[model samples]
Target: MKTKHHILTYALLALSISASAQYGSQKKADNLFNKFAFADATKIYHHLIEKNFNADFATRQLADSYAYMRNPDSATVYYKKAVQQDNVPIDYYYNYAQALRGIKEYKQSRLWLKRFKEAGGLIKKDRYLKDNDFLNSIFNAKHHYFLAPVNFNSKYSDFGAFEKDGTIYFASSRNLGTLKKHVYGWNHEPFLDLYTTAKRTDSIVNHKSKIKGDINSVYHDGPLTISKDGKTMYFSRNDFNKNVLGKDNQGVTHLNIYKATLVDGKWTNVEALGFNSNSYSNGHPALNNDDSRLYFTSDKPGGFGGSDIYYVDIKADGTFGTPQNLGNIINTNKNEMFPFINSENALFFSSDGHAGLGMLDIFATVTDDNNNIKSIINLGVPVNSSKDDFSFFMNKDGLSGFFASNRAGGIGGDDIYAYNRIPQLKIEGSITDATTNAPVPNAVVTLLDSNDNKIADLLTDENGHFEINIDRNTNYKLITQKDNYIDNSRTVSTKGIESSVTSIKANFVLNPVAKKEVPISELYPIYFDFNKYNIRSESTAELDRIVDLMVNKYPYMVIKIESHTDSRGSFAYNDKLSKERAKATYNYLVANGVNASRITEFNGYGERKLANGCDGTKNCTEAQHQLNRRTQFIVVKME
Candidate 1:
């Protein structure tokens, strides 16, 4: 993820500037923009643009207003115009790229990103320079998702989905009659409130309603977490009370996490967490499986990025411990938020700090026993896109769950989407020696798809057992090879597997290559026309098999190709023809990927080693003569 400064912070900065009489309308629009009042600011900026008053600046500000409002459609229009102006700031170009990505215009987004990088005044190196190929590879990669929009989405922002006990809890700005209606200036939408729905099916949901209580407030609320026991809950809300509205030095109110306990079937005792502060924002809380640790995102100072994921320990006496930053492995110089921990202790979060397709992408990482973050992996599209994606939640099964994305075709500004992971097929078996029927440990097994494209490579464990997951409804070939053994392969297909995870047995038995030479005729016969030196088409399959063995199985083995002829012509002429045939065989192997250096020699042995009595003086059937006129391969050296 490239570091694009948080546009919301810029809006706050704009509010701090004093108004000047010389630029009355412009100053007013700037003031509105700083207050996160994007809707009204948009109008003021648009009016100034119509009057042709500082049109370029108005255009950029207008775009910023829509962008911060999560309306990429309108933002792109003004951003496109703003970037055309001479000496436009590099951030504008980056903003334009994000807008393009929001609409699924990836190709155009990439082009704008190129221009952003070329402008070249970045403090942090562009991640795209190293991850463009990787990000692009996702389009062609196998994705198991079966994605669909949730049924209850409204035109307003609807996101932050979490499922517990067959009921789905989410945060949305949809208006309700019982709640006092107040619009958030950021998007001119009703302040967010927690809502719940019941799952009808894996892909369908029903019974949407806002939670009833003091939880619904005039200010923003929700994007919550429930304890495993379902008795306690932690949720995000603005730091505003009836008496006082908390504000930071920048005059921007921040979010805080509050805890509420279920008493007599009602959520009560809502209190802010001890660690929350007015000086910095903290929200989007998630608890570990046992609720011993709480994870949340914050823009607190001394953090590595704009917002970073942090966790605090919950003691036995219900006391809190010092918050700990997840560190660089999970946090970067850009925002990382919306942390979710699955059953496997793998942490999933959204980050704009890693290399991704576009704006914030969802990433997952596992931690060791010491609770240190390890490698991080992108969820990839269609789970992730060029638009802001966050608030990921899934079950222990890893088969299905919900996430939020502002990608195109969504039902609202940021819609909650349900996804089911298609069933995966597995191929599992053991490798053994043909002679002894004993496990062959450490044998290399390679998997290839129908097109002979390599899929995966594995080594047999001490028990000679190996198991690997493969794509469903695909044909595959498994090649098993080991030192001093003849390689073998088996074809397997999962075209009809219907289970969530189907495991099919596919065993391999490899023969040990004898100390003496092994004849190629034992594997497959090679036939030729009476006087032809060119390879026959029927022999290609067998020849390719040999090539695969030499390249993958016996890298240190050298081979010798022997071509012979029946005692029909003069020895000199027969020898010359035999040599040509042997050379043709050798060339085919080399062209098919077997290294030329691996072939020790190819020689003609005309009538010297006849398979049967087929001498020129004696009359013999054509079958007997054909047996004498043949090509053979043997291992000349093995090291």
Candidate 2:
């Protein structure tokens, strides 16, 4: 009994110490993460994990650490492990949902959020209204269903859905392999085909099963959209078979859109949308409610780049006019495809070329009377991922939709996921100069995707206020740049977090040199030890001023570094020193990121070029000598 008691006492002591240590470690980890020392916090979490102390929280903490460190991939792996441990808190689900969103698992994130809510998790409904992840810019409390990409059974990798009555139509490339040969050494999957599923409107979420369609093809076919009246159907297909035959077919290998008429509740043979479907390749069609215009994707020449959204106005005879480029405002030198126009006159689309959540997430905008459209705003976290997420479609009511993604937990490559739109909203903020406190107006504000594309350029107002409407489920890079100031950037991803407006203030201090009148010459100054070639300490101060000047006028101004030597040295020696001096100055400026184009040739006038009559004697006065031993900045060009 005595020995047993001793052992028991020892066991209790050990347990106490272990518990205390675990709590202490957790505190340290929290502190580290709070300070943004993600790497350091990660180390501590790993140590706790190895000890098997609070394994669930430790793993999650580690995952959060990775997220804070800007390493989402690693965070995702750990978050999954934590979830697997079971008995994890709803907060774990929240963080895991965020990781899923960061990696472009919009559907999966939705599932997690749903699970969190169902598990007695109470979150502010208005949180998403202001959160960066919520981009819909409109909200409805009744629309609460979130479609998690993981909810799709592995049997079908589907996306881009349009519903009518009891059936929901979506795109999938499962089984049929007509485009299999068109792998093109890339990740091209089988051509997508439209499928229908059963649905009911009463439940928060309605399950779907694929429906048969006669227009199914061996080629890529899918991303089917229907007009408001459900009389017109649009889908995308690609003839990869042409490439399998070793034929040079540029237009066929890509996507080709088709239009079909729904007669007597059945879809007929799809007809090519005509000249709008030219040799350059066009696909991803979205018809306006009026049926007078069809928006589609095309990579035709004279466009901003690989693919740009183009539309054809329907003529009275049911024919389309020549496709006109949507100009640089909406199109960029990047791929902008997969468009969906909702009944509300809002345009939804996916893009790698536009700023977004990840590789390719959905974006939307409302058009104005001037034909000018608002910026394409990314659908936040739960609906977007770091992987390719294209093929977005929505119903007229904005309650349900579909999108494609190749994120983790999917059945295969680029699986199509279904999701009910969360009624949350998008809120945007603009950064301005505090002193002027006025809008930094016309500042180039770029939203980066996972692929790092500047998705949009936001201009500030007279109040220095820039704002954007957003939907739930997206990620973005908010970067601002203006003349005479530093470029500032921020990364925001909203997954399972609360919906709340987040305002970021990126105020810039415009340098005096960045203003008019202060020329490049005003910034450069070369110092010398009386008449010597060696750079002096005083010159560093002058050079620092130049460095500041360059920062203010980046991407503009072209200047040259020229050096001269006094007659006190031999012609040969003076020439060599002058060259060294010029090179030194040039190297310094270049190292500091002054554009190489801004500064050009460095001429060594040596003693051959004397600023003042360098009395050809070593005993010259300092005033006369100072002229020949120096460097100056000459402006080559100005913006």
Candidate 2 lands at a TM-score of 0.41
lDDT of 1 at 227: 93
lDDT (CA) per prediction? 0.75, 0.60
The reply for model 2, stretches above 4 Å from the true place, is 1-156, 176-190, 200-214, 239-252, 276-278, 421-639
Give the per-residue lDDT of model 2 (tens digit) for 547-617: 77776844576566778877776777887788888888887778876766667466576777687666574
lDDT of 1 at 572: 75
Q: Give me the runs in candidate 1 sitting further than 4 Å from their true place.
A: 1-133, 176-180, 200-208, 241-244, 249-251, 366-369, 427-470, 476-492, 496-639
RMSD of 2: 25.8
Model 2: per-residue Cα lDDT at residue 199: 49
Residue 81 error, candidate 1, Å: 54
Q: Tell me the TM-score of model 1.
A: 0.52
Candidate 1 per-residue lDDT, tens place, 1-639, comes to 123323222110001121112135665676555433456677888887776655777899899877766668988999999998755668888789878877888889888888877887342245334434565446655586668557878777777788888888888777745445687876677778887777623332222376755575677787888999998999988886554679988888888888988888667878889999998888888998799999998888999968888999999998899999989988998888889887655678888888888888888774332445545768888888998888888876666788888788876777888887774456889999988999987787888877765555666777788776666777999988787876677788888787565588998888776676544444454766677788989888889888877777667777768898888889878888898989999899998898898785687887788888778778899888888778888775566
lDDT of 2: 0.60
Cα deviation at 607, candidate 2, in Å, is 85
